[model samples]
Target: MLNRIASFALATLLLITLSACDDSNPAAPEEPVELDTQTVEDLPADPTVTVGENGRPQGLNQYTFFSLRDNEIVLESGTEARADSNSTAWDIALQGTTIRINGGTSGPGNGAAYVAEAAFENVVEVDTERLQPDTEEALAIPTGSGNGWYNYNANGQNYVRPIPGRTLVVRTADGDGYAKIRIQSYYEGAPELPADRQAHPSRYYTFDYVVRTDGTPSFE
Candidate 1:
């Protein structure tokens, strides 16, 4: 009996020691998602119906009104445009990416953090009616005032730089569809603004984004 009890105690200690030494590895972190980006060009300075170099009134990238005045891209609705006598021809604005309906009175709001995508394809489709405004997933666009929206890099060259890989996703104001956007630049031709010329007539917003018409989460 004594011998059997001693053997059982020894086995119990060995089992405890083995269990304490078992170190399971922790889980791996999730990979970041990649979103598709779209680009628009020569977005006019306002809804003045300026004859773009392409000789066309600015088409609403799915918007009823757009303007690049007051150092801000003011996105108003058609009714607001008509009521205020503003042009209802512009679509997207650069200060990051903002959109409003034909009659909306405000620009995109600071609602929520934009959710990045896993993978998306770039396109030239500016269908706003199908795109939804996501309030929770919006980001502020970079402007050319003060610190503006970009960081100045002095390491390689004194150049105005953009926040790399920063983006936003928004649901349409009506809550029907979705759109993803990212600011590419605040200057003409998406050129890097010179550090010496910080106030060089900003409000010229260049960006890439995708609009989803199917109301699904997939923006690819």
Candidate 2:
């Protein structure tokens, strides 16, 4: 009728001008995910043990009993090696990378106060014995008795050796015999050593200790 109502209002104004045309060609804002970083030449220049961020193992790792705070070091036995582990009075606390000989005591000789509960095991065995848990007849550790039974400077006897990729086990409550020595000497980036039946481990960066005949002490 009036030209079909002006052609149906011009087809509803061209379908509302193509639905307010921006026809969606402007949707490009999504690009921000680039995180991949590791530089110390990408780590492991000479690493053998690394576990940092306080899960308690840093730099060089090995532990049996560790109680730490900062960068502490206390290797006791008449002390004089200190990084301040409370200036220990030799109650046997080999601070971090663990070794703690603490458990029970009543009283006896050869300076009593090391009675029971200090077990450790690694195991291989080749028959060896030496004791002085206070004395009886379980001898032969006299390889040059600085007062044998492991002539002390704190149990390791001033580097007759062990610590190259170390594994040490020592105990002598007398005839509870244990000594599998190593560590010709050490310090300065060392780790990864095996194929040692004694050669030139004399010292370059030694931190080696070998004591096979793995386990002992079970008074039950």
Candidate 3:
């Protein structure tokens, strides 16, 4: 029995030595303490509004300078877009010179900026004695398509020579906003003969008008 006890003691000592050998290397290095790194992503604003980089105004406006300069008036939003210009954008709902001139665009998609057609004749002031108040819209596209005059008439009787350096006041009849549209119109090239569809392909005399705004107009 004493020999067996001595043998057991020897076995226990060997087990301790083997266990110590498994962890013999400087505390087993604590699993190498790995540091983890994380990543993140950035996103844009709300998902409702459509954002396009194709010349949309700096402040994300729907209306641009080209839109205003090309047409006599424009609504800021595509929702309330009226078709007056003969371009592809014109729709049947806005046939002829049907600009409401309310000075704003209406609809769900309207952006921050709105543009109105800058007229060459906001106010047509002619000498009263020679008054020819013709309400007919003289749409003269002598060399034109994108922009021309409409709903404008000669409010004087006798046509007078355009005075040099004379500024006339044109205004927005729907509101206080107004601009000078024309200075004078006259005969040019050849007298255009009335036609069934097209105005006899001849250029007529027309007086140029100017636009006054807060700053140089912009589109995109």
Candidate 4:
């Protein structure tokens, strides 16, 4: 009886020791999701029905919805984009100079955004604390000539251009991760010098972005 009890105690002690060793060295965390820089060109943001005298989009007011996760245009039509505006299928929406995320007053998703003054490549990590969702009073990405991501009639060029050193850091629609966007041009074909208003259509977006789906905040 004494021998059996001693053996049982010894076995229990060994088991406990093994369990402690296992706990000390937990499994390594899974690797963060890998993503590549993606460029989206000529994404129509409510292509104008007519060019005004000032060389801006006139009439046919609408928004083009885009999905950062899917990396595709979710909705391009005015009616369809509005109908699905409440859904999380899209992460961002654009119309003229206005940009919207899929959170707050925009949609039901957890999307949020803030414009970073750093260059796109220089922004290696996301500043999650500064992010804000769209609100009725104001948008996460502010609009206007000198505000947010663009400058209107820059250098008296008579066209809108993305402001240099301005990058958009966004909390993805699902709120699972983050993304960074650098708008290269606001004209069709991403012309180097969009001097001719008629030749270079307005409201078309050319931008590059990188998205991480693993919830990591670092772009590297």
Error of 3 at 174 (Å): 13
Better of 2 and 4 by TM-score: 4
Using TM-score as the measure, name the better of candidate 1 and candidate 4.
4
The whole-model C-alpha lDDT of candidate 2 against the native structure comes to: 0.29
Q: Count residue pairs with overlapping backbones in model 1.
A: 17
Score every model by TM-score.
0.41, 0.21, 0.21, 0.81
lDDT of all predictions: 0.43, 0.29, 0.28, 0.89
The residue-by-residue lDDT of candidate 2 on 1-220, one tens digit each, is 9999999999999987776665655668886433221111111112233577887534342211211211122242233443433332222233122223222230121111121112212333322232222223322222232322122233433333332332233442222223332323322233233235143221233222222122332211
Ranking by lDDT: 4, 1, 2, 3
Q: How many clashing residue pairs are found in candidate 4?
A: 0
Could you tell me how far off, in angstroms, the CA of residue 132 lies in candidate 2 after the best superposition?
5.9
Best by lDDT: 4
Error of 2 at 204 (Å): 13
Candidate 4 global CA lDDT score: 0.89
Q: Tens-digit lDDT track for model 1 on 1-220? A: 9999999999999998787767444467886345444566535433323366788645333333332112223443222444322343323333222333322334332222233322223322333343332233332222342232355543556454555544445544334445666656655556666444444433355656565545555554
After superposing candidate 1 on the true structure, give the runs of residues whose Cα lies further than 4 Å from its correct spot. 1-37, 44-149, 152-160, 195-200
CA lDDT, candidate 3, residue 154: 27
Model 4, span 1-220: residue lDDT tens = 9999999999999999999999999999987556799999999998757788899648477788899988998889455436677689999999988999999998899999999999999999989899999999999999998789988877777678888999999998899979999999988999855878678888889999999888988898
The most accurate candidate by TM-score is 4
Give the Å error, residue 163, model 3.
18
